[model samples]
Target chain A: MAAALTRRRFLGCGGVLLVGACTGGTGPAAPTSSAPPPPPDPLLALLEEREGLLAAYEATGTAHPDLIGRVQPLQSQTAEHVTALRLALALPTATSTSSAGSSSTPASKGGSTSGPAVPADPAAALAELRSAVQASGSAAESVCVSTTAERAPLVGSLAAASACHALMLS
Target chain B: MDPTDALQEALAAEHAVIWGYGVVGAAAADNILDRVRAAEQVHRARRSDTAARLHEAGAAPVEPEAAYELPFDVVDPPTALQLAVELESGCAAAWRYVLGQTDDAELRGVALAALTACAVQATRWRRTAGISPATVAFPGQ
Candidate 1:
């Protein structure tokens, strides 16, 4: 829908805000920034988006029980991801460079610790989930799935799950 | 499939879900209207977050057109659920494609989230339509 596309366009305007390392020192943009040049670190963006995903899930209601059950545990993992990123970001030592020539710093030290916990209102939860699912599915990057060996089945499993969701709704 | 590539495919599927829900949600009854709205929000949120992630990753996220072609006609909630089921299934496939290509532990977590969401949607649709949800996990797999 026109309204839907516009919503993203509105958000895109904030792309500039997602810049720079936590340190004041000058450097390339963060890896999460849309700019073609690799940013200082991608872990920050991952943390922000992970929160968004959890928020959406909390909004989803009972319409998607299967989805909620499956993802509830992973929500905790995403929180852990934020913690790991923050730790990585705080490391006094420099990180090794990826083969792609990109730097591999961890997430900013201030990443969130909140998991996607909420009251058990299946309907409300499903609504939240619908949003989270969209956000999660729409994200298309390799920051986390860096190696080729671990990538394929992850994508396949995601796809199959999506297909299964479609069949039930249809 | 590459991680970015997989995410793109899943994004496309999300695009379709967002598009199709208009008709399906509209037709759903009052009892389930809230559910319909929630699903719509899911699609919207997903679309936005996905695009942001895409941009963050330096990939231009595909813009959903002003309109999208639906897989089938939506006449009622049952029909809507039917369409939703189909859409969810397609989304599952797209996410699966992402699962296939992704390896990074973090990205893998995202792919798993996607997988779980789609499967839940599919199961919901099946129950809505009085269809059986197969006990075996990841039916296509």
Candidate 2:
């Protein structure tokens, strides 16, 4: 949980890069400096988190076929979230990458891998999902506090959805 | 875009929701009436507080409509629950707009709480309506 909170802290503090509209400049651009720009925007990071969640849903569903009926809809909704986030960020949707190459990691740990390992046990998989949803929701709310007003509601809704998902999983 | 504008909109939504719940409770079975009453009370309190906030800010909050257009006929328990879901969803959307209009932590906190409550209420109503998943990717998108 601490790690997850830290990830949220990173997202909230590093959100200025997401919109890139705050640059005040009436004069010519300054000479390029050696200093690197801020790391990738946390909005992108949240999108990647959603991607990982989609993978988790798919993997868990595949591992437990009996749960497919309940899992497919969630997978579809998570896909929609990723699409919406991508559109909000003005990024083109990319084709699915290599899931096989991805590794299982909790969202709080910030693993770039897409695949999140699901426990073979159905109950345990649900537990994992609850935790992930809670963490992702927290991350979304953190981003909400820093983004533009137009975009904050988008993230806020994501957080609410995450909370709802956690309830369903429970 | 001002907070008052959003607050007024939220107050309007709360009014509609409180009015809608009256019809909803009438159509709901005995077991569901408790839930309806609870929801109505919550919205009513919220409406009062919102109006107070608006008045404090020197903005005149809009009055509730004499009646709101029902999305559908509330003829049974299922329909009542569905109406409840719609009403809460409306509240969620309105509060979300409020969130977009303010950066003040106190106001933001209020908006966030209201939005979250409405979303959760929608989920509960969906469950009562026998909707699977009972949740959405976005509540007010």
Candidate 3:
């Protein structure tokens, strides 16, 4: 899996060749000795979105321990998504502790302090989680449509998986 | 593969799924027969839509086989539910392959919807069958 992820990143960087866009005269001047920064990857937003969803799962699980049986499996699946997206972006894997969900820690690179607070009622909490999953699935579907063919399968699968997760939550 | 080729593959899977669902509906208990019938109807619609899309693209849509070989004997509700999961999983894979074959946004949208439907239906069947962790991390991978 790690090897495949590295290969995808290598191919993506080599194939797209965004240098022309980066080097266009409209951009700020770069030092001649250094390479310009690569354009922001679209997948980065998706990766962060997955992380946020994972945090929501963790928050719900922690707040309502009785719902753990129902929440744990989905949370684990969401964690897998986080891992997959990270690998796809060629980002270093998060330490187990970080992903295990310390609420004080930011859920994503955007630096949100924590996931949305869980409702006191378990049923309501599940409903909230379902809404989040549905929204996430929509976001993933949009990304799947817009991303390169090489990346579409992964994103599309994530969108599908989120649909299933939403059903499970319901 | 060409986009049309991928669509043909998806159409073929939908054909097999429609055939497989007949066995599913037959073996499923009366309590769940409605669900089985609904699933079959969805596959039939998908098969028709896929075939039409292929025809529009000027490619021949593959026809369904007269009889499909079942992976196992689906003689009871348990086995029927299992077959349902298998059918959707196969369709999901086919549609996922289509996503990789086309850059057309419209085609990708259609493929994604099909894949998502398969994943959701698969989860429903798994849940009904008492499968733990009913949702997979990657639906079509």
Candidate 4:
């Protein structure tokens, strides 16, 4: 079982390598006789979803400074999700994109903001956040149900974590 | 591990969780007794469902021991709440393992739902106990 799991993980890493080679300018070109491109990895979509959730949490915190204490912990957890998803994909550790320029300020005091439109009311903002988390959880569950057993555990954990996040938001 | 073996393990965990919740409910405060009962009920239902699944798969589900050794003495409400958290965490871990041992979509759905339920319940227990960061990043992992 352990060897099987290792092989599955190695295959996942190979997928990431293929993606990287295809996208990176510095990487050598694919051979003329290369096999057909592999199917797109579902983990990439999950990674994007987690990064969006992190951004949404950060925006909510910025919009409602008073709610930062409540939001920061969940945001930190989301950041951890982003990291785990990256690790599952065997991707390089990039600088935290979600933390850039996330300093809390009073600039978005009113209802609407330049970035993500966080509701003016803290309760409403939290509700919105909860909805997003719920949606992401559903997505993760769908992927978990359909993906290979090797990938199911990671997405399954993501789904479970999102459920916890939704409960916290509630 | 075989999927049936994983299911058996999850059933064993559920049996233990149901038993642990008896201790949890006994020591829980009046204000939180409802939550304790609700959690216990869920575990009981899961236990029955898991046993049924194992039987359907032609595998004998693992039965619960006469009693499980408590990780720590459940002497008070705080300890009881901590036990509740621990119970759900165990359930989550078991179901997560099931996820990695099966490719059946229906089984995966069951495992994922159970994992999510346990993770949510664990967060609730943590919040009740005033634990920091009530939600874990990777619940079963």
Candidate 5:
């Protein structure tokens, strides 16, 4: 009981010291507008792009079998981000319409879509996908570096996938 | 006046991203094909939503072009991956900037989403390129 009390006392004193060390600017020049804090990193923009790319790929349904499996898992992971964003923005949550079942997709049946399998040119399809995978992997790595609490698994996995893409392409 | 202006900027970014995806998707490998395309679609929808919201608010949306200049030479898969990382990393900075200018919750929401999306894309591209993308700089410099 005495040890517990001592720990509490220490924590209380530490808290005061920590607060003393912190500094808040004074004077009219320093404006801390209550705008919801700006995002610490810029990687979310890339993730948004990836969401579109992933959807386009799924729409094509021509992804390699292994890719198909890998993407589905990644899609699930991305949904967490989708939820976090909605909460942060105080926006309504998107309904899941992605044939992928990850988020609310605005796509209609008639819209023309593109994917890795559809290759703009069939002969160069593998080469193209390999390049894209590598690119996607690199993009994912940057994301990990930029933010504190976003998409680590997906980023790391993408990096690995890019390597795999090169092998598959070869 | 409202968050829509910032939203429009984000839409513009999405347009550019979709364009980049087109180039990379054209040559993405078989295994990662689905992921590449799926991510593109997400951006398209986000852009569309932002555009609509801007239009509703009487904001002029920035139109995306058929193509944009690549940051690096994409002669091969590895090279392309490196370029993709740089491209998305650049994009992340733009969105982060937008997030800073707006205080509207809706804008913040989209900004958060966009930021997260860019971060993920950067990570994937970095991993694919076999480089460590400074994961330590969370929240970014």
Candidate 6:
């Protein structure tokens, strides 16, 4: 199905002049309108979970220098996944000031902020990473059920990739 | 979007990969040729299944190209492994789109298996090639 266009503009002056200019900026700059935040995109949760996985990989590498060779690649790939997921979800990587001036705050961070704990042993680290990947795969699968058809493949691939990672670490 | 379109595209990719893997297996090292052949068989099976599914759904499955343009020469074992990597990557990407577009639970399950298998095979090829970061974070993207 074609995606519905959610963004629109109403032009009052014969569809010629800008709506803001014609309305004399009297509508409180569109922020005081008190619109509720959009329900979180399920993909964002997957993305955040990926970030946590990256952090886990990084921490494992730091704690066990001997496993750096293995951990580094996983970390790099996890970071890449996070970046691709953010792009696919149409989310900005970094926070940007809102266009609605000084009074407007950027959207709140929508998902988990916790990172993986440092494991005690190399085997434990690998196990932790594998478990995390499995969880991520499950989460991505859930996102596939809720997202639009345009995004389902990307999300589904993420799940597949996560499973592959788990298999690799196994 | 029609889920069949995604399935047809995946079928096409599987057909291409099955063809490509024949070349890949031919040049692969003795140690890995069996694996390459196995991968080829996997894609062939998937291609057949996808076509059958599309037919059942009342959508005409796409036919494979007469021949595909190779991404690179499959000269030696490394190059052959690289080709396999590329082929499985294409397969994964195609199935990813299928998973996204399909709403049928059974079809999604099929697409998911195709995607996971392709991704695992790609990682194996990457490992055989001694490529860094053998497993991708996102297979299709």
lDDT for each residue of candidate 1 in B3-67, tens digit (9 for 90 to 100) = 67667777887888888878787887768878877877877887787788888999988867678
Clashing residue pairs in candidate 6 (N, C-alpha, C atoms within 3 angstroms):
A1-B1, A152-B100, A153-B100
Query: Model 6: per-residue lDDT, tens digit, A67-107?
Result: 88877777777767777777887766552212112111112
* Model 4 spans > 4 angstroms off: A1-36, A98-114
Q: Each candidate: what lDDT?
A: 0.56, 0.81, 0.85, 0.84, 0.54, 0.75
Worst 10 residues of 2 chain A by lDDT: A97-106
Interface RMSD (Å), each candidate?
A: 8.3, 1.4, 0.5, 0.8, 10.7, 1.9
- Calculate candidate 3's fnat: 0.94
Question: RMSD of model 6, in Å?
Answer: 8.5
Error of 1 at A63 (Å): 31
Tell me the TM-score of each prediction against the true structure: 0.47, 0.82, 0.84, 0.83, 0.45, 0.75
Question: Which ranges in model 1 have alpha carbons more than 4 Å from their true place?
Answer: A1-170, B134-141
Give the alpha carbon lDDT tens digit for every residue of B1-141 in model 6.
Answer: 478677778888988998898888788889877787777888788788788888998988898888999998889988888898899898888887777676776677778778888899888788778887788767876
Which window of ten consecutive residues has the lowest lDDT sum in model 5 chain A? A100-109
Instruction: Name the weakest run of 10 consecutive residues (lDDT summed) in model 6 chain B.
Output: B100-109
Per-residue lDDT value at A10 in model 6: 35
State the displacement of the C-alpha of residue B79, model 2, in Å, after optimal TM-score superposition. 1.3
Model 2: per-residue Cα lDDT over B35-115, one tens digit each: 889989999999999999999999988999998899988998889888999999999999999889987767876887788
Deviation (Å) of A86 in candidate 4: 1.2
Best by TM-score: 3
The DockQ figures for the candidates are: 0.18, 0.55, 0.78, 0.75, 0.02, 0.52
Off by over 4 Å in 6: A1-40, A85-92, A95-115
- Assess the local accuracy of residue B140 in candidate 3 as a C-alpha lDDT between 0 and 100: 87
Please write out the lDDT profile of model 4 over residues A39-145, one tens digit for every residue.
76787767766777777888898889998898888888878877777788887656375442232122223523245679899899999999989988988999999
Better of 3 and 5 by lDDT: 3
